[model samples]
Target: DQQVKQNSPSLSVQEGRISILNCDYTNSMFDYFLWYKKYPAEGPTFLISISSIKDKNEDGRFTVFLNKSAKHLSLHIVPSQPGDSAVYFCAASNQGGKLIFGQGTELSVKP
Candidate 1:
């Protein structure tokens, strides 16, 4: 079964606008959530994260909000830039660093 799901395969947005991406999970046992930004053929870089105890986390231009009751989470990017164009992966781990990722949401920031 797929524990994590990113429904959108891609999203395109203007450089100065807001971009939002969504994700869902099936397992409630997951206690930690993370978002990774990746470039073509490259390893994912950590963006932001939140513990099960928190509802929202933000870092610079990126913000992640978690709704534990609905088993859902979302990522928001404000004033998106061309450099923000990349694949975004949402991951979760129960204990250690081992993470399960979504297929990915490709964001294209048009300048």
Candidate 2:
């Protein structure tokens, strides 16, 4: 069974607004959670990450929140811009260095 899951396949937001993406996981052993943004023809680039010890982590306009007890996580983008439009994937890794990714959620920012 897939350990990571993204329930929404896509999300749309107005520029300058906030975009929220949701992800869930079944594995409790995951210690690291990451979000990656991917363009159409290029590889995914790391966005933000949160360790199990922290409830939240922020970087510029991106923020990642983790709820260890619920096995859920989310990414929030404030003042979302057009350039932020891309596929976002949630990844989880145990101490083994192997990552499990959820099906990506495509984000569209409207101008």
**Which is the leading candidate under TM-score?**
2
TM agreement with the true structure for every prediction: 0.96, 0.98
Runs with alpha carbons beyond 4 Å of true place in candidate 2: none
Lowest summed lDDT across 10 adjacent residues in model 1 is found at 93-102
Give me the runs in candidate 1 sitting further than 4 Å from their true place.
none
Reference-based lDDT, each prediction: 0.94, 0.96
- Cα error, residue 2 of model 2, in Å, equals 1.3
lDDT of 1 at 41: 93
lDDT by residue (1-111, candidate 2, tens digit) is: 989999999999999999999999998999999999999999999888899999999999999999999999999999999999999999999988888999999999999
Query: Residues 11-60, candidate 1, lDDT per residue (tens digit)?
Result: 99998999998999998989999999999999999999999999999889
Q: Please report the TM-score between candidate 2 and the true structure.
A: 0.98
